[model samples]
Structure formats: structure tokens, C-alpha cells
Target chain A: MTPVAPLMLLLLRVTSPCDTGTRVVLVPFERLALPSADARELEEATRRAVAAMPDACLESREDTLARLRGSGDALAACGDAECRSAQASALGASKLVRGVALGVGGKRSVALTVTDARGTEARAQFEAPATAPGEADARAKKALEQVWSPRTTARATREPQGSRMLPKVLWGAGGAALLAGVGFGLASRSTESKLSKNGGECATAGESFAACFSSQLRKGRNQARTSNVLLGVGALLGAGGAVSFIWELP
Target chain B: MPLPLRRTLTLGVLLLASSAASAGPAQVHYALIVASNTGTEKSQAPLNYADDDGARYYELFAPRSREVVLLSVLDAETQALHPGLAAKTRPPTRPAMEAALTRLNARMAEDRVKGDVPVLTFVFVGHGKRGAAGEGAVSLLDGPLTRTDLYARVIAPSKASFLQLIVDACDSYFFVHSRGALPVGPAYAEAVKGLLSDRALARYPQVGVVLSTSSERESHEWSAIRSGVFSHLVRSALSGAGDVNGDGKVDYAELRAFVAAASQGIDDVRGQPDVFIQPPAQDRAFALTDLKDVSSLGYLLVPTGLSGRLWVEDARGIRLVELHKERERPLVVSLPVGKGYYLRSRGREATFSITRASEVVEAGGLPWHDVSVASRGAAQDAMRDKLFSVPFGPRFYQGYMASLGIPQPVDEAEADAALVP
Candidate 1:
């Protein structure tokens, strides 16, 4: 018993239960006063570092870029956090990481910003000087570690399961649907009002009202048709939001 | 024979004899635990924990005792103290209790025939009062049990070699002294200690008595301790914290000293419990309990380093064991420990196991309930609600328990010896 006591005690130490469930997407880092190759190298190195993190699942850069189209240049200017957040939600990511490198010649000052579903933003800035030809990867990795080291990784990746943004997505889409419906309703009302005001003009005899009356009627019909489509879509979306609310927990 | 072999044989024999004295087939324990929350109609408030306390006693004692009887109108949600006696639970009427005693008498007679010493313990966890005629009477479901009746019908007829009686209630000092119910006054408290040297109770040499009140003040209840203050102190003392000699056994004297020391630190005078124990008039300490007697217990090792008060409850939230532990005096519980045992210390709680006898379950290794992010208000409210559920609770700490013979709080270091918090 005495000989095996240490072995037995060692076996009893507790292990961590599970991961924090934070998925991150690193949008390509913007290059400033650096060659395209250097920027690409930096982004690739940082992506690898993030992918190596045991607690984070890195979203594919390609898919992120494709989804974030027109939300400003993905690398050059990542735009406001709301745009980046929307892109993250649209890309099915719980967290977004954007980086920008600023410096002339070889050395660069790189700033990395990570945002979560709860609108929480964490930024890390470090100097990543250009080293030997193959040393770029090592320097990039070292800079990333110094700024966002594994020692502090546990605190950074909270249980951001994208729960915060879920309600917003559901309600936002629902409200958008309703707004389209209201616009269509107003268009229908306007067309009806114009037709009523032009009632005598269309009814007048031999005033070449055939083409004009038909045209007015056609315009009203188009407006009414578009209004109906918008209203129908809006109603379906609102109903969808209600159904979602009844289905999933907050 | 060689000297070493002869000495070894002698030591082995002593061990066998010691085991025989406490357990080994030569002895049997029979307990009649009466936990009644409802007293006679004249009583002020019905006790909330009386029935539960009785159940807790059963949980603690029934497993090791040869035979046990519980008489109470148990709540529907009341958990069974032990599996075997759940079906045998009966109401707390005097006739039914008498019947249970009759059956126990027969069993004791059989044990006597078998040449076994029956260690009989009678526990009353309920209310008590002094009648208008000036006699101490324990309130029953039907009526008051007078002091004379207790001796005439119960104690005098007892056939066991040793008798242990524990009464946790108000005005209980009159049990055997033939004294009338004592009232609350500044002077009476001083005179109550005079009973410490009384010859009348001293004559009962064989009977060990633990009474909760020495004067009119109560045997109160405290939610922090969970059990009635008097009973909880006794139970905690028996759980090994009372072993002042560093020996693993707690006799009646040790328990008395421990209870006195522990209850002395209570801040409110009302919260002080006036405890009285009848010391044996002979040489040998009446070893009330052996902490190592885990033959029927789920042994819990509260390992070294952990200090402060700790409590355990079952899955049904029935409190099982509570003890104030210190480093030099680590506590090991014989309560039925297993999967559902919720261990609480310093307001933090966790679940632990004794699934296997070979396993030495470390107390600190268990998965604890996360209270770091939980609201302090909600936690406090929950404790308040739980405490409030027991009747006569406010009366417990509002000067109900304070009486003569109850000591004032000592320094913090001395206070740590007892269950102050």
C-alpha cells in the first residue's frame, strides 16, 4: 500500500470537463505599406496559430469572405463591428477575428481584434518584424503567442455558443419581413388613391382615355401584385419567427 | 512458550474481548426514538424538526442498533430512516409506544436469556414542560407524560444492563429529580446547577441522562445546524469532534464536555443551550459510542487540512451528519454515505460517494456545486426558506434556549472548539 500510494493519488487528479465552444473566423489580415506576399504570409501564419488552439474551431476563410461580400474589403478595411458581426452570424460563426498590419519596409505593427456573439471585443497588438525568409512563420507565431498566449487563452474563449445573436437574427429577419409588407401596403394604398382621384379622367368619353386608362389600370395592378407578394412574404417570415420562438430555448 | 508469542496471544485476546464488549455477538442495541412535532394543545408552537429529527436519529442510529422503533405521524414526504422499518412506522400515541416497548421488552428478555447485555437507549426529540402542579412532563401527541410516570412505567421496569436516555426539549431537568416544572427567572438559573450534585438523580448510577434544558428556556432549533440545537450538538459530539482525548471513542463525559464547550460560544443568550448529563458514579467512562464502529456505517473521511463546520444530507435533503472539524481533529462520519449524500462546508456544497469499501474517498475531491456566479440573495433566501419551514424556529434563537447554567461565548479560538457558526 505504501509503495503504490503515490500511483493511486496521481490517478485521482481531476481533468477538465469539456471545451468552451467558441468558434472563430479570422478574416484575412489587412496589409498596409507591405507587399501582397508579406500580407498573405502573415494571414496564413495567424490562421495556423488560431487553428492550432484546442478550444477554438477556425471557420474557413473562403466561406467567410464569400458571405461577407460588400461588407467592406475583407482585408483592407474590415468595417464596423456590426457589419463584421452580421457577417459572422451569416457565416455560422460565433466569433470573428480581424487583423490589420501597419508599418513600412520589413517590420509591421499588427493589431488583431476578436469579437464574440455577445458583442464582446478583445484586441491584441504586437510587433511582427520581418525576419529571415522562412522565419516569417516563426516570428508571426511568436508575436501571436506573446499577444494572445496560451496562458491567457482560457479566459479569452468564453462559452460563446452564439446564443446572444440568435434572438436578434430571428427578430431582425421578422421585422424586415414586416417592413417590406408595410411598404407594399402603402404602395397599394397609393395606387388606390390615385385611381380614385383619376376616376373622372378615365371615365370621360373620346378623350383618348383607352391607352391612358389601360395604362393606369396596369400600373395599379402591378403595384397591387407587388404589394401582395411583399405582404405574403412578410406574413410567412413573421409566422416563421413565432414558430422559431416556440421551438428553440433562449 | 516463547515470550513474543505469548505476548502476541495476550494482545489478540484483549482485542477480541474489547470487540465483544461493544459489538461482537455479546451485546445488542435497542432504541425507542420518539420524535413528536405536535405537543398537547396547550403548547405554543408545533416543532418543525421534531418529526424530521426523529427520522434523522433513525438514519444515524437504526442501522447499528439491534432493533429500533420510531413512533411519529410521519409526513407523507418524510424519507425512511432505514429501509426495513419504513413499513413498521406507527403513530405517536402512548398506547402504540407502550406496545412497541412491550415488543422491545420481549426482545431484551430474549437477549438476556442469551446472556447478552442489552444497551437500551431512549431518545425523545420533542417538546417538554412543567405542569401547573410542578412536575416535568414531556408533551406527547395525546397528553403530557409526567416525571413520575416516566420512572414508574419506563425507567424502573427497564431490564437492560445499561440505560441511556437523551431528552432534547424545554423544562426537561425534572425528569428523574421529582422536581416541579421550573420557571424562568434570574435566580432559578443559579439554582439549577445545584442539581449537578443532587443525590436523587445520583442514585440511578446505571442510567446515563442527557437533558436539553436545565431551566424554563428551550431546547431550541437552529437552521444553521439543521437539527434542534441540543440534539445537533450531541450528534456532532458523537461524530468524533467530541473526542478530546484524541482517542476515537466518545463516552458520555466527553460528550457532555464537548456539548458544553460547543454551545457556550453561541452569541445570543437565547441561542445558548443548557445541556445536562448524568456522569456515571463509577470508574470506567461510559463509552457512549465508538467512532470506528463502521460495521453498519458509510465511513466518510473528511481528510486533513479542511476546517470549519460541515454537514451531509441524503438525496431527499434529510440532514444526516454535521460536525465542526479541525486539522488536528479530522472527522470521519459513519452516516450512511453514498451517491446521494450532499456534503456541505462553508456554504459550498457537493455530492460524494462511498460506492466501494476499498476506496478511500477524499472529501475535497468531489464535484462541488458552483456558487461563484450564483446570486448571494437567492442562496440566502433559500437557506431562510428552509429554516422557516420548521415551526417554533424564530422562538429558537429569540432567547428561548437561554437559561441558567448556559455559558457565555468565549474567545474566537475557544469558540472554534464547538459549533459556533
Candidate 2:
């Protein structure tokens, strides 16, 4: 009925939720059955935490409360994305944040939901020791982190897809073979070059020369053999790739 | 580059990078490749493949040469609005060639300032004729360049320690010799003696020369090679086929022998190739190219056991190089390397690394990609008069890149403007 309410609906209907905008309306936290709490101020603490987001601009307390009061019992209590989206559409806001808190035993648990016009919603919950004062704000930070995470946004739109493991296994095997082949091939060439310059046999002049000559001969032979095997494995994968390529040939 | 003033402007895109000097290991190579198909106003017939052969030279030297520039007159077929063609847009006149040389010299000057060694080579493939004064002159796009002009312009100002001049044309022997045309048997000896007496070349310690003709004869063009007979033979020699001693290096003797063998079993004349080489106070062979150094030189590793002769093709699917391996020979032979070449033999196509890096691309690791078979005649038809013909090759590009791409430019000015970021 209000003129601004109709204008807000036009904005919400035209603009996508993907655009970065600051339109957050938080209906202050409420207890399960009490019209008002005689105890500590929990709603104000929740409001402070949600407003801390870099892209968030909270609605005036008077406007948010007046809209909530008009809803009466038909949809007075809303917790789902559809219900929250409707509330945001009417206010021409981009997002609506709503939450509840309760106490059991020595701990108090809190839950919050943030919904946008795209029918996407994210929720976060946390529990803290109720014996301490100001636990609402203390637990608010943790709950807000869960709501703002990229994974949470992805989870709302689709089922998390899992990657196939077989291709990864093949890639790992091929990469390992290539690494081993290069290492052994380099070692074989280095030793061959050295033995070509100096005689294969050790000189009588020094122990280092003699040991180096004997060591290179054996090591070079071993490396040459190792290099051949690794190269063979790499070739097998290349052949496999070739087969797949041929399958698609015209 | 589109130049507004010329009749048929050829692109001479110069891609240069200032490389760091790591003591003496790094040597900057600069090349000026010129190809002129049209002759002077009233003299010679227009050559069919002159500019294309120049492009072939550009492709061959690209992998090894760092600072490469092309000075050519590209026809409509090869130009295809290529983005690389820009700068000094005039025809290959004497002044145009001089301007190109000046730009290259200024670039190499920076390299010398950075403590890097410079090596320069001049390659010209075109018409050669005798001027009215009886002096030998090679055709430029707009005119002819005389021998005296060449000495004064190309060689005199070059500061490179190692210099090579390769000219493939009818009257090329006149560049260094006093004769107006290539000479015959005993006259060839006299010509060499005359070249040795030249004062300017004698002052240069390290210099090598390869002239296509030794006597006044037609610079024959053979259709089989798709290039002039002399240049094709010389290129064939550089492909390791000329390494008669299996020394892994193609030197002056090896190249001369290869050219002679091509004309073997003939009637009266042997193929004539002239060489004038002087080492820089060192008696090392005038090694033109190395086949074994894959890191510096482009090479392909062909395994021992491949049956039949292996034929290689360029990126355009045009067969260019060939190889045949026997078991009695070494276990592997290094295949001649160029940019974007394919190995095809017996229905099998080889895929290997051609990047300028140290990794050895083993024969065993080559991936075989299946391709649709075309008849031998179709393969032969694919070779002539093409620019960037790899579209029919195995890359099989589906034509997708960025979401918003610039449309192809319509004119030279727009083409140059599109190159800007």
C-alpha cells in the first residue's frame, strides 16, 4: 500500500542478486515464546554482528519492525529462503537476515539465515557457554563466517560435484615416470661425458680420482638401465593417448 | 605493416628482444633475408618463387636467429594480410635495404653494449644481371643493386665478428669477383683468386661466402624442389644429408660435395658452388651449421628401427624434408628441425616437442595422432602458394578464444592499429 514499498518491489524484481548491493534488513532476534525479553539485550548484539559485513547496509529499526509487525501471525515467523525473499521484495532490499537463539543446560545456541532475491539462502549456527555475559556477540562472529563462505554460496545453488579419481591416478603415474626418466638420463649423459674425457680406469695419482672413475662406471651403467625403463613407461602412456586419438579420427 | 607509398608493400615485421649476457655463452644472431620476384623495369622475367623462397629462409633461420628481419615483395597469395608485415614499407630498393640494415645495426649495438656477441648473415634470393657498365647487379623490388653498392652498404659497416653472405641468383658470383658473369673450369680458379685480392673482405678476419653460380649460367629452377636448384641443394646440404663424414657439422667442403653429387652422372658439367671463407685468425672449418646441438640448433630424434623412408612436412602439411634410417648406422639420427613441422611415414604421424628448451624429445615418447588419409597427389597439391595453411592440419581449431574478439582488420592501417594492446 505504501508508495516506497511498491518502488522497492520494482527494484527487487528487475535487479539480479549477483550484483553487489547493500540491502540487508535484520528483524531483531526473538525468543521462542516471549513477546519481549526482560533479560539481556540479544537482538541488538545480533544486529551489530550482521552489520559488520563490508557490503551490508542495515534498514532502520523502525521500518524493519513496522513491516514485521504488519505481517501478524500468517507469516510473522519466517525462517526459509522463500519467506525471507518475499520480505526483501516488499522492502526493495537485496537481502534479509533473520535468526533465533535459545538456551539449554549451561550453553546457549544461536542460528541465523541470510536470503537473497535469487532464492538463495545461507545459514550458520554456533553454541557458547550461557553462564558468560555477552555470548550472543561472541558466537555471532563464528556464525557469520559460515554464512559468508564461498562454499556456502555454492552449496545453496547445486549439489557439490565430486571429481573422478581415475584420470588423476593416471596423470600422477605418467608425471612420476617422466621425472625419473629425465633424472636418470641426465646422470647417464654426465657420467659418459666425464669418462670420455678421463680414462675409465682410475689414475694412480690420487684416491679421489680412482674412486671417481670406478664409481662413475658402475653408476653410469645403472642409470642407463634405469632411464630405459622409465622411458618405456612414459612411452606406454603416450601410446595410450594415441589410441584415444585414433578412435576419434574420421 | 601496411605502407601507403609503395606499389606492393611487403611486411618486414621486426621482432627483437634484448637478451642478457651470461659471459661468453650467449651470442645474438641477426639475419636480413631478402627475396625479390620482379626484375628491373626492362630487364628480366618475374621469378615465380623468389619471395616464397625468402619466406622459406625466414622459417629455416627463425629457430636459431634472434634478430630476424624480412625484406621481400609478397604477392596476394602469401601476404594474406599477415600481421607480421610492417616497417620500411618501400620496395626492396637500395635505400630500403640500407634502412633495414641501419635499424638492425642499431639494435645489435644495444646487444654489444650489454656485452653480448653478435653474428650477422645476409641472404638474398632473386634475379641477377649485368648492368650497362658490365658490373653484376642483383634485382631489387624497385631496381638493381650493384656489387660495389653491396660492399659499401652491407659488409663495410657490419661490426659482427662472424659474418656470412649467401647469394642465390644467376649473376651472384659477380658480388665478389671482377667478372660480370660466373666463369668456367680454369676461369673459376681465376675468379676465386680475384675474390681473394679484394681489400675490404681481406680486412675482415672471419667471413664466409656461398654464391649459387661459379660461371655465367642460368640460375636453374627445378619444380621438384619448389625452389631454385642452387638454394634447394644448399638447403638440402644443411639438412645433415651433406655431412658426408658423419661429423655432425655441415662445413664448406661438405656443402660443396653435396651440390656436386646432385649433378652427378651428367654429361659435361658438374654443379658449381663457390666458397670464400676466412676464419677469425683461427684455422677452424667454416662450419655452416651443426646438426647435433638440439639446444641451439633445431633437431629431431629419429629412432633406429623405423621402416621405410620418413617424410617430414611443414605446419601447412607441405612435405619438406625426408629421412631414411638403416640398422647398420647409429641408433638414432637427428632430424632437421624448423618451426612447426610434422613427421609422417607409413600412415603414422609423430608429435614431439619443438620448443627452444633442453629437454630431449625421445622417439619412444612421440604421440601418434590419427589423421584422415589423403592421396599422394592431394599431399603434393598442398605445398604451393600458401600462407598459414595449418588450418587443414591436425590442430583442428574449432575457432574459439575470448568472448569478445576483435574482428579481422580490413586495411593496412587498421591492421597495424589492431596490434596495439
Candidate 3:
């Protein structure tokens, strides 16, 4: 039997704008029969995610290419008719919403070369079945970095409004950080509860550290005090991160 | 019944023709049946019994409103009474049942379906359960077949010299399990070949047999309209529907198909009947042709010249012996010892046997002796093959076209190879 080639990258882009400037989206398309079948499901998933973007102007070539390339809206042709039409089509908004979303679910086995026709540049291939949610975003970010790298003088002709990083990237990152913080806080709280319950018992149970700490000597009390302070500090940090995300919401 | 009779007669004729055209009349076939039912259960009141080949198969059922009937046509085209057997529709009594069984055994011992015939068949039908000693157990009757009594009376006495037994029972194979783990597929076929080995059959070779289980041991719910497990299988196998091979007759090999098809209603448990031939005391009578009506009279010299043959021939175009002339004379022929011979005669009926008399020939010089009168069809078949041609060339082939004696064209080759000087 032939071993399958490992995935190098996976790009998952979403355009939902319900609470924040950008949504930290998921691109779980690894449960299909094969790559081709996966692509079909992925396309549907992407369309649904994009159409759900709240308050975001839909565009075709402009927004999609910009998001994929990570170009800011300031660089896009704001009043150009051709650019507007292209962008609208890319975002799948000019016509009535098809209401149907393309769904993709399968493992991508090999590296696929996706090229931008207008830019005449070969984009990096992202291996699917990404290791984790962050891994997929990391790959997408890397691909964008490659496209807009300072070393590369040439850029794609069409730039859309939705993909402009000034608002979207900041918002997406802020939300992801907020979720991560809340997750950490919840985890810490649970751990603290467990620790408190065991604190007194541990000393009586003859556990060396707990016994020594439970003696209530000035030194041991100081050590416990320090640990509590650290936990409090961590909680504070988590709250601050959550507030920053709320501040970034559009 | 009429159709079956016509078919039987036609088959008789065809067999005679094929034998005469093929090799000698020595085609070894057999039937082995194991019946174990005393009809003691209330639901299984009456037991129906028939002796085929040398084995007695019992079909047991409840007899209440009506009398049970047993209609049988033996291999010789003769109607015989089933002495000690009781049908479900008949009254139940040990004495009556024993008497019937005794009479059947007596008849079988008294007469024999002699000669080298093309094929032998045995069929039995009776009420049976799915498994042994379990809820929803399988049985031929509501009760059980006593193994000891069966072995002593039915099995030992009437074992067909060369015939195959076609059995239809739900848990019929429960006994084989007592014997050990059966090899996959059909154990019956292997057992048959093993039992009737050329060496064994040469010494014996009575008849070939096949049995089919209508229902499995775990299944086979009692059915008022449908026959018992054994009867169901027998009927289906004979209907040509179960004929896996294109051969006109459903031989032992086709039995698996019957068993498989019948297994649907018969739970997961499967049963295969036993088949093998018994050693004959003398060379089996093989009917080369069927001389019907006046022909039979003429062939047997029954004061009617309409049918039958004066003599049977061997491979060398040599007349083996005059048949149907008067008495049952043993026509002996000289053959290499330890080899098999195909016996054929005017009737399509035939069997095979080994030469124990140091030579292939009977006590007399010829290879065959005839005791029964022949029909017209039987005579034609005999004339085709029995009229021998040359020493060793293709006389057998010519005889094959005519369809007369045994020693088929193929067998001649085998015989020549097996011949010991």
C-alpha cells in the first residue's frame, strides 16, 4: 500500500460579521471520501460562511481575492465600476442569494497548486486535514504573507473591501484571543476549586509538600500567598483579553 | 401420478439406451438412510414408512380424522406393500406398525432389483423437528426415531445392494454430529465416494444415493399443508427445479442445491442425508433396453414376440448371455479380477458389482443372466450396445450410438488401463 503524502497547509476563511469585525471560523472538511469530493463540500461551506457575514458588503473578485491575499481596502479601487462588479461577483452578492451553501468534507491527500489568474503568481498549496484550528489559520496567514510580501513587487489587479485587514484581521484576532482567554479562565477556576478542596486534606494525608505547607509557618504561608496571587493575575489577564475583543467588535 | 409414471418409464428407456451406448452395465450407485422415529408424541401419532434401496425411512405425523396412505413404486416398476410402516392418517398401534415393517423387510429380502442399471433412488417423508432435545426441537415425528431399532430392523436388513438414499428431515443430521465434526460443504458426497470407492464398490457397488433436508434443525415449524422435511426436499429435488446440472436426472451432486434452497424456512442449522451403495452378492442385472408390451413378452420369451431381447452383449460384440429366456441363470464372463463392470440389460435398470469369484464372469461362461420379462423399449436399448463389434477398436462408440450395454466408450479406456493382462 502507498503511504499518503502529509498535508503541508490548510486555509479556512470565513466572512461572518455578527459580533466582531471578523469571525474566527472553522473549516472542518476532513470527513469526506476523497479530495475531489471534499472540495465540493468545502465550496458549499465557504459560500455559507461568506453569505452569513453581517453588515459586510458582498463582493466577488475584490473581497475574495483580497481576503485570500490579505490586502487592505485602502488599496482597492473604491469607485471603479469594473472593480465593483468583479468584487460583487466574487462575494456572490450581486444576484439573489442562492440560499444554497456548497459543503466540502474530505481529507486532502496531496499538495494542490492554486494560482491567481490576474496576479500571475502561483499561490502556496495548503494540505488539508489541518492539524488544528490554529494551524489552518496559520497556513492561510502564511499564504497571504507570501502574496503581499514586500519582496514581491507585483500584486493582483482586483482588491475587495471585505478582506481589507484594517478592520477584519484586528477583529478576528481579538475575538480568537477573547475565546482563548475565557477558555483559560474557566480551566483555571476548575483547577482552583479542586486545589482548595484538597489543600487541607493533603497535609493530613502525609503528603510531604502539603504537610509542610499546611503547618502554617510564616514561610509556607508566604508561598501559598504567592501562588494565589499568580492565579489572580492570570484571571485578570484573561478578563482584559475578553474586554479588548468586545472593544474590537464592529 | 400418471406423469410420474410416464417419466419413470421414459427414464427407464433412456437409461437402457445410455447404458448400451456407453460402457458395461456396471454403474455403481447406492442409498443410505437413517430413520429414528417411533411416533410416540401426541402430535406425531401415525408414522409413514417406505423402504428404498436397503434403507427404511419413516415419516411420522398425527393421525386423527383420516387414515394415512402410502403409495410407492419401487425401482423395478413393481408395486410392493410397506408391511410394518404406519402413515399419520392411519390408526396408531405398535403391533400394526411392527407388522407392516416386518412385511416390508420380508419383501425386500425376498426379491431384489437386480442388474446393472443406470441409477438408483430412495425417497422418504415424515414429520421431523428442527433440533434434538430443545425448545422448538427438530424431529421426523412429534416424538423421536429410536436409533437402535432402526439400525437393527431397517438399516441392516434392506440395505440396497447399490442404491443412494434421498432423505428429507429437519434435524436428520443430529446423529452425524455424534460421529464428529463434518468437513465443510456436503459431507454426504464425500462419505459416498469414500464408501463406494472403486475397490469397495467393485466388491459391492449397489446403488448411488442423495438426501435433502427440507428444513433446518432450528426451524421446520409443523405445517398441515406442506409435507415433512424429507418429503418436501424430495419433491422439490425431483421437480427439475433443483437440477443444478443440465443432466435430465437430479443426481446426488444436485442435492446441495436442494438443501440450500430448502434452508430458508429451516433455521440456521443444516442437515445433509447419507448416500452409498451396499455390496451385492452377485453381478447386478443391468437392463440394456426397455421392451414394453408385446416386445417385453417376446424379449422374455413370454409367448409374445412384441418386445425385449434374446441376449445382452459385452464390449467385444460378444453376446454376454441370453436373457429373459426362461429361468434366472447366472451368465458368467471372464474378466480381470478386482476391476468394476457395468451391468446392463433390456430394461434401463442396472447396478455394479466386484468379481469375488477370482474372475469377472459368472459361474456360467456369460457375463449376465436375466430373470424378468423385458418390454419393447428395453429390447431396443439392448440391441444397440449388446451386439458387440470388434476386439478393441471403436465398437464401444458404435454401441454408444445404439445405446445398449454398459462398458461405455469412456469406460473401455478406463477398463483397458485398469485391466491386469
Candidate 4:
């Protein structure tokens, strides 16, 4: 009885979820002018990285490609998240990893996307020198490490309040202030013109020139002051509004 | 003449006429392209690439069009670069433009009499200014072609089924639509509103407009590319890279999206060009260029497995069809088949030639050669590096279409067929 029990326990341990791990199929990396050897090396580095993860298992590239071919879907065709997820399900794996290796403009960039059967996706990108395949290999592994972790759930729950509307309101208020300033400036100019034209006539009536035009002068000065203040405020507000609007742009 | 012979001849002539009538009416395309380096005012600096841009457009459209009238005074450099094209163009004066329009309209009228469909495309690439009265005007050799003049001469006199107007210049928005009070911030929103409310343009439902600058912003030219930024993009779009859905036709929306994506990576706001594109009011799906109709141009196919920022340069070093390709989608760019061209991506380039019309060269099969790196100043690098940095593929197309609140114009089966393994 003791021997049978121990043997059954050993079998149970072999079949445990922790032992078998999660099956992940890594699709071949889509290459753009990348040397075949470098692309494969980068892919292998990524595989080693994923294998190093706890409770993670990787399917071979040959097996994955065979399944994809048999299913009549090429690796390049599975570009969207949904397609990748479907491929993952079809392969009887819980996760799929895909990537693209680009060699252009004397620079090399690798981007990886990991999608699970539940349609959750994570992406990572890294750039390395085209001459250094080793650097690219290291970066590819680092990128895999980044995407393998669970995404943070602490995203901001609500959009910034009045981020857009505030700019519009500021602009509107500034525009109104500018219009009012223009009205006041025009009034002041008109008063000055009238006073200049009639000042001689007022002086001829036997009063001092300053005394004769005091009221008109006071009105013009007050209007000019108000216009200046309003114009300054309007200009400030307009500038603030422009800065805020540009800052809020996505 | 014998009675039997006369009767037979009469019957044959009647049958021939009936067959000709039964055959569908021919669809003729006409283009009038005007480029001016000099402005009407002395303060306006002479542009370096306006004539070159016009000549490139002529090269693109001449083979496909039934008749293309080019109005430009090509400089020595431009003429040397594009051999024999200078002889085909007239001086870019108002009177020459008017005469060309008259002739095109007469031909269109004749086509109409013969029950044919005629399409007119008018292109202007040069300096433009906003007047004190907030009116927009483009420079010509004789004088400015104001918004009113455009409405009266180009739109009103056209008898075509569609009239496509492409203006690449500063303040082109005001050239196409009148502006009211100047806005404090960016004037894009105001310009669009003005365009929609313009009564003159509203009257001509067949008229479509594509302008370089949507506001008072200056349209910039890149000496590296040797063309106005917006004009180059437009020419590339018309050449077939802008056929987003692989529909073999480029529409207004596609062209707009293409230009936006191509220029989105520019970090400097001053360097960025805001484009305004509106299709004919009567037909939202009016195509600017039909690839099927352009049989004289050759195509280069960018198949799957190749991706990244790529450009095609002709033998004269004129960069055409700059785009960021994606691995999943295949793209086709049309070009003149007479010259050899190079397809370049970053450090690698491949040369190919199209010897005949309607030729499609498979770019993936070409032998690529490694290019040596050249050191450039940061400013030049910034300007050159940002072009086509954003990927133009299905994802961008889907997002753009979603933003526009319009259905994606792709046939799933056809799109799948367009993809190459």
C-alpha cells in the first residue's frame, strides 16, 4: 500500500499545472532587409528569455510554422491581435508571441507583440545598431521581459476634467475683451479728434485752453487707460489659451 | 452609281454609326498644371522648386491624360533634370492660364456634345498671400489669381463631370475659400468652416479642392526633396501609393490620410504643412486618379516580408513615393516606365527598370546593395529623417477611417489578394 500511494503521488506531481507550465507559441519574426542569421539569433535570444520565466513553456518554431501553414494562414497575415489570438487558440497554446525585425537607415529596430487567448496584448520595441547583432539580441531579450509582465491596472480612471473646454472658454473671454478694448480705443480716438478740432473754438470763448477742454481730456484719458488695460489682459489670456490648447493636444 | 451599291454603302454607314453610338461614351481626362517661381509682389522671395514640382506633375499626368497643358517657365536646372519637358510648357501667366482653360473647356464641350464624360484637374504650385481684405490669391507671371478669378474662370467655365483643383502655396486656404476675421491661434478650424460656407464653391458641386496650407501658415519646400512638401506628397499619392484600400483608385480621403501620415512625424510645427482636402459635394467617392486608366505608367510592387521607410528615386535623383511600409500589406507605386529608378531604404538600395507601359516590377526580387552612411547636420537630418517615419498600413488606415467616421473602403477578398507571401 505504501509503494502504490507513493507512485500515485509522483504521477500527480508530474501532471500538475506548475510542472507542465503554460504553452506559448512563438511565431517567426517578420523581417525587413534583416540578415537571416541575425534574425534567427534574435529570435533564439527571445526564446531563451521566455523560457527563463517561471511556469512558462515554449513551442518549437518548426511546430508553430507547421500548424500555421496547415491552417492556411501565413505568419505575415496574422497581423491583428484577434488573428494572433485565434492562432494561439488553434495551436492549443495559451499565448502567442510575434515580432518584426527592421533594418533600415543604418539602424536596426525590433518590435514584439504578445497576445494571449483572452485577447490581452502587450507590445515592446527596442532599437540597436545594425552592426551589432549581439546588442540587438540583448535588447530583444529585454523587450520580451518587458512584455511578459502583467500590465498595470492603476491607469487613470477618468479623463482630465475640462481640459479641452477650458481653452475654448479662455479664448472666448479673451476675444470679447479684445473687442471691448477696440471699442474703447476707438471712442478715445474719436474724443481726441473732436477735442483737437474744437479746442481753438473753446479757447476763443475766453477760458484757459486746459480748463476749456478738461472734461474732454479726462474722458479721453480714462478711455485710453481702460483700453490699454483690457488689451493687456486680452493678450495675456489669448497667449495662455493658445499654450493650454497646444499642451492638451494628443 | 448603281442602286444596289449605293444602298449597301448607306446601310454600312448607318450600321457603323449605330455601333459607335451603342459603344459607351469615352471618358477623357484633362489636366492644366501651372507653376510660378516669381510672385506678383517684390517682397515675396522667389521659390527654388516650383517649376520642378510642376514639371514632375506634368511627367506624372501626361502619359495618362488625354491632354495635359503645362504652364511654367522651367529654370535651367529643372530643364536639364527633366529633358524635353520645358518645351512642352508655356509661360505661367494669367492670360496663358486663361487661354489654356478656354481650350480645355472647348474640348470638354466638344466631348460633351459627343456624349462623353470629361474630367478636369487644375494644379497650381507657387507663392500665395492673404490680402488686407482677407482674400486669398496665388501668384502668376502677370498678376495674382484671386479666389474670385478661380471661381469665375476655372469652376464656372468647366463643363467636366469633375473639376479637381490642387493649389500648393501659402495661404492657399484663402485662395480656395474666403477668410473672415483672423483667428488668434491656429486657423485650421476657421479655414475649414469658411470652406464649407463658401457660396461660390458650394454652387459648383462638381468642384473639388486640395490646398497645401489650411490656414495662414506658410507652405514649405524641402531642397533635399527638391519640391514643395505638400506637392511631393500629392504627386506620390496620385502616382498610386495613396491607394490605401488597394482599390486601384485614389480618392480625396485617401490622399488626405496619406499626406497626414507621411507628415505626422515632423516635430516642428512651423515645418509642418496643414492640408485641406475636399471631394466634390455631389460625389464623396470621386477618385482623383484611377490606376486602371493610367496604363502608360509602370508599377513597383512592395510585397510582404519587406517593411520600413522606403522611397523611389528616378535617374535624375528626384525622390518620389516616399512611404513607410508594413510587413503584412503590399503596396504598388506607379511611375514612368522610360527611366531607370532606385528603391532605397535606409542603408540599402536596389535598382530596377520598367521597359514597357503597364509593367509591374517585383521589388523584393531585385538585388540590393549596401550604401555607405553619410554624415549630415542635425537640422538637415531632422528634416530628412522625419519624412515617412510613420508607418502607413492597415492599422493607420483603420484608425484614420474610424476618426473620419466612415467605413473602410476595402474589399476583404481583394485586399487579401493584394497581399504577397
Off by over 4 Å in 4: A1-74, A77-250, B1-26, B181-185, B189-191, B194-198, B214-219, B373-376, B406-421
Cα lDDT for residue A232, model 3?
Answer: 59
Please, what are the lDDT tens digits per residue for candidate 3 over residues B302-357?
A: 11111122333323222222222111111111221223333444443233333321
Task: State each model's C-alpha RMSD to the native.
Answer: 23.1, 35.3, 33.9, 30.6
Weakest lDDT window of 10 consecutive positions for candidate 1 chain B: B412-421
Q: Which ten residues in a row have the lowest lDDT in candidate 4 chain B?
A: B412-421
What is the DockQ score of candidate 1, to 2 decimals?
Answer: 0.01
Better of 1 and 2 by TM-score: 1
Error of 1 at B416 (Å): 26
Question: Using Cα atoms with residue i matched to residue i, what is each candidate's TM-score against the true structure?
Answer: 0.51, 0.46, 0.26, 0.60
Error of 2 at A20 (Å): 75
| Top candidate, metric lDDT | 4
lDDT of 2 by residue, A112-162 (tens): 567775567776655544346677676776677667643356554554454
Give lDDT tens digits, candidate 1, residues B1-421: 9743553454345334444544445556788988888777563487777776777777656545666788876664454434434466677778877888888888898888877777788888777877666677887788877788777767777787777888987777765455534445524433565654453556566688888773433337654434686787677666555654433466776676666555544544555677667645552367676653323344555533355556776676656665555443234455553446778765588887655221234463455664432344643444333321221111222232263344323312321112110
What i-RMS does every model get? 31.4, 37.3, 44.2, 13.5
User: Candidate 1 regions off by >4 Å?
Assistant: A1-250, B1-25, B79-86, B180-190, B193-199, B214-219, B223-226, B282-284, B337-339, B356-360, B364-421
Q: How good is the docking of model 1, by CAPRI class?
A: incorrect
lDDT of each: 0.58, 0.54, 0.31, 0.73
Instruction: Single out the weakest 10-residue window by summed lDDT for candidate 1 chain A.
Output: A70-79
